[model samples]
Target chain A: MNEDKKIGILDEKTYSNQIHLIGRVGSALLLMFMLGIPFVIGTVYDCMPKFSWLIQPSIALLAMMGPTSVSEVLGYAPVLGSGNYIAFITGNIMNLKLPAAISAHALAGVQPNTPEGDAVGTMAIAISSIITVIICAIGVLVFIPMQPILTSAAFKTASNYLVHALMGSMILNTFGKGKGKTVIKNKLMLPLVAIAMSVAGVLLIPKFSSYQGYAMLVAIVITIGWAYLLYKKGVVKVVNRDEK
Target chain B: MSYLDIANSGLTYTLVAVALSVMLGLCVVFYVKTRKRALELGISKEVLNKVNRSTILFTIVPSLTIVVGLFAMSAMIGTAWSWFRLSVVGSVSYELMAAQTTVASLDIADTATADGSVFVAVMFVMSIGALVGPTLSAILTKPVTQNLQKAGAQNNGFSPIMNACFMLAIMSVIIPIRVSTGGLVGLMVILTAVLLSMLIDKIASKGVAWLGQFNMPICLLVGMLSSLVWAKLLG
Candidate 1:
């Protein structure tokens, strides 16, 4: 409600200035501790050899990812808290069963290049890579027991819908700010680039599923490029264009 | 067999999820006020009004939608949670768990329902957990160090400890989250919380940087705790 609190110009240069060093370090340490638990360790061991390193950070990432996904799906606000609960729970929990991606995504806030960003960035990278490994493991684990369930229930179709529903909501929300043409342009470009990159990876690499990072990076880069182009060309003038 | 029975079960968990959400929502509202010191500044009224409007639209409407959606989804899925009668569709892990449970004859095909009264109790308790977690965090971390000068806390080190404890409690619930919703959904749900946090702060740029930063983790922990408790007690 504090009208003065509303920032007029949010430039990309100084997007999130409130990145706390103590907070990021605290979160990272907590994440490392949480990932070192017995149940988590045991689950990683049982799951596969590749995912062993993931058990700890994945817990933290999952903690972060839940809030992000929910907000995206609902077209609401995303949480930007330090990973307190995530760190705590990861350290203490017995049967940590959260997906690996959540943890990776959660740690995304930890931007390590900046003075305080280093911890967060490391945390993010660590957790995300760990999660990717876990997902690969889960794919392998589920292959045998899951085929019957998948074929019978048409799970691929259902999963596609679920993923689409979630991603569609995210796309709408993310590009909700721009003008009609710009929004549409970015929207069109993002999917096309993502799919094209995905297809390229699928053709080039035997295993398409393992290239999640590549696909995600390509999509992100394309979206960023589109946004930059739109901004540069004055296609999307956000909040008080007449001033500058 | 009856519409009433189906409605009753759907109503129970739907309300449970809503009530849990509301309690946590109120806690977030409360934290926003306290951390921002909105009441003292006399700006809370405007924020409250905006929140109230959004609450009605976001909380109430979605709660209702989920209630109806849950019921319809459950029936369509043909396999509902016996205890709560809530829909378990798209949850492959739960289906697998149900398939694997030999002790309870965890029959995925069994449409046989359990006594609905039990879920009523389960829902009530879960709601309480959701309510308690945030309030407890607020109290424990309620900024004992006070300075009339600065807009922020004086860094007395207590806040950090409280934060640690808060995170620890949330971490504890991961096991239960894994058990009930499977690891994947639990992960997604947590990310969803973060996503919501970012959007909330962007919309409500009310100077409460701490709230913007920490709200998602708090909500994630509280929400999961309640959900975990619900799954544990009911299942």
Candidate 2:
């Protein structure tokens, strides 16, 4: 029964959607515009300054491109496409005085899987870009020059924890969902697996002691095993049973 | 032009940008609402199969409206308008900034104030956004429920590969599109969030049940507001 179920789940019928035709073309066009305008403007602004008036229009055009009909765009797609631009710009606007990676970390939280926890988490990345930039700018430009001692005291590694804060939020979100069982199981056993494989490799290859292939081999095995188990147990079973 | 005229043009450009986004967004909301209604009302299987198509329409409609609106505004405003012409002015300003810095550098031999320093700064910031957004999207997209609580464990048959691949494709398309010529910054940020969500299938995930797929207007509104501020202050 399990075998049969797995086969059914792997089939293509499960991928069928309910979206309409007009919706498809419309969504594509909107996505193009939303994605296209800012890139053009930013690239132009960054590359050529002769056409400065295009900056605001470029921003306005990009802002208006958010997902409307499909809930898909804002949930995950933006993190990759539009969110990157936001982060990049946020970092740019701050003049890179702020750690640029923080923006990506923040937007990662807006992913749709987490329980609606706090508005801060929702807006943390977006807010952080502005806040960090302002804080850093003041510290670097005004405070440092005016009160070197005080500004130096304020400068600490703690300020850079924006990325960590965002990551913690993501970890918390994943844990809250209770769906990371597979990940947890793998993480727990992987240490033992790693040790065993390392010892075996040393014993089998006398001259290969310097080789790291053993570790790579172990990782491959574990990944393949996990994927197979997930496919057979989760994916296949779900698809086949639903068809019934 | 008089100060009042300049003020009016700026304000008008800002409003028009917002209006376009809101109108486009509203159309999408309505389209989704109607589609949901159809689903609830028991649309035929054949019709249901086309629901995705309808959803696509909501996005396309708003997109077209935005493009047309931009062209119309640009033509009406004239070549010297600053609102929608970020590329043209920023380049010139930065070049001026570079030239000024170069002269200063030549006078003092200070590399920190040179053009090279500015390039590094901008690139560094852009990289940060690229890394964080995708990671966040991936983390947020983890499923809430794994095995069903019923008799036997039944999977949703969700394809992580498909999800990841689809997201990558969506992101790939969106990144270039927003950053391309004539693109706006506000729309880009909002769309980034949207694209992140879509890539991770966050909309379909239970935790963030309210996530939407395509929303150009909200992004545009927020982005425009910020851009306007950026322009007024930084311009």
Candidate 3:
């Protein structure tokens, strides 16, 4: 009976429905909270921003961040799966939440964009969000004393390199696990080309430096195009596991 | 009241408290729902526990970096507002940029002499500007996931390749920034991390199971440590 129940739970339709329900409700609540903060601050302080005061700053910020925000949602949704709703609200998607979700999926031996992987990713994101709130709360309490140490030059440099280290290691870990020439070629070539192009754009084109805001979007498009071409050429085969 | 006083006022604290409560409540709701769903789906407790532990460990360093950022921001905007922003929608770079842009637009030299009006404007702009990502994700994630699933259903290999490409795109953007700024030292650190991770993977295949879970974090530490050494040698 227990085994039968376990098998029943793996039903794709039921799992997807539940995830959809949770994501919709969670996102609606989060959107409310996002708007509520400013409203609360404005009302409580009795310093509601004038309509005019909001215009220039809003334009400036939107001009800089608008495209990046759109691209982030589009890019991360597929990788993050159901965790996207949770992660978007908690913020820090790039630096913290996404990595945690990926690590959780890897640890559980689940692949991304699947029902099982979605559950694992969601759980991981929840735990990470809880930990982040706790850490930030603690940091606020002891911030005065910790300020000097945290801001020290040595620590700053380390923190700066941290993301690069994390990302580089992740890439190598994925690349090193390739099983054949086809997998290696398909997986490695496009990214290497994209990186080279981005580096050149940064160095050679002064205009590209100003448009660093769109660099990630541009890189993603290039890689996706390359991957699609490979797929069309039959170099990228889609293996159907269920058939086996 | 003065801007700093307003920034540190009881009202501001109340705002933080309210926002924190809402965030916590949502987390609990999501947690309960996700767990119930997972159990009903028949996922083993062992797998769930492993993922939970690994995620908590993975979050520590990055969360601390955010804390470090919060400290800097608090010095500029007062503890209450800084805490509220960073705890919610704001990141270090975005919050700082938003604050600076707001102040500059008003022609204020610094946040020190800025009034409540400036504070309100800054907060408003920051909050509104950040709405795009979460809003779009909330509305689009389901449709997007369904499409990806449909694509995968037709060809399982397509999903994995798409996933790999997405990761590569992100890394390609990040690698250049580090290389551009850190120069030789940054390159050395990144190369060290890549090598360390590859080496760990090789060892893990030989039966060191625990190391596989920790390969990224360990590589991060080694890369940071190597940067210090490189900095000294290059100087």
Candidate whose TM-score is highest: 3
The residue-by-residue lDDT of candidate 3 on B1-235, one tens digit each, is: 5567777778887778677777767766666666666665567787677667667776777888889988888767778778877776678999888888877888888677777767777777777777787788878888888787666545444556765676677667666766776678778888998888889878987999767778777887788778778788874
What would the per-residue lDDT of candidate 2 be over residues B145-226, giving only the tens digit for each residue? 1111111122243332222222222222222322332134323333443444334445436455323222222222333334
* Candidate 3's DockQ: 0.59
Local lDDT at B188 for model 2: 36
* Stronger candidate by TM-score (2 vs 3): 3
How would you encode candidate 2's per-residue C-alpha lDDT over A1-244 as one tens digit per residue? 9998677444311211111222233334333333343344335434322233333333332232212211232232222222222222222221111111122222222222111111111122233333332333233234224343322322212122212222222222222222221222222222233344544554565543223323333333443344446556543222221233
Cα lDDT tens digits for candidate 3, A50-125: 8888789889888778787777777777668878887888888867777776676666665666666677777788
lDDT: worst 10-residue window of model 2 chain A:
A113-122
Q: Which interface RMSD does candidate 3 score?
A: 2.6
In candidate 1, stretches whose alpha carbon ends up further than 4 angstroms from where it belongs are A1-161, A178-195, A198-209, A225-244, B1-235
How far in Å is the alpha carbon of B168 misplaced in model 2? Answer: 15
Candidate closer to the true structure by lDDT (higher is better), 1 or 3: 3
DockQ of each: 0.03, 0.04, 0.59
- Worst window of 10 by summed lDDT in candidate 3 chain B: B150-159
TM-score per candidate, in order?
0.29, 0.27, 0.87
Where does candidate 3 stray beyond 4 Å? Answer: A1-14, A178-186, A190-193, A207-225, A228-244, B31-44, B155-159
- CAPRI-wise, candidate 1 is incorrect
Off by over 4 Å in 2: A1-163, A175-226, A229-244, B1-8, B11-235
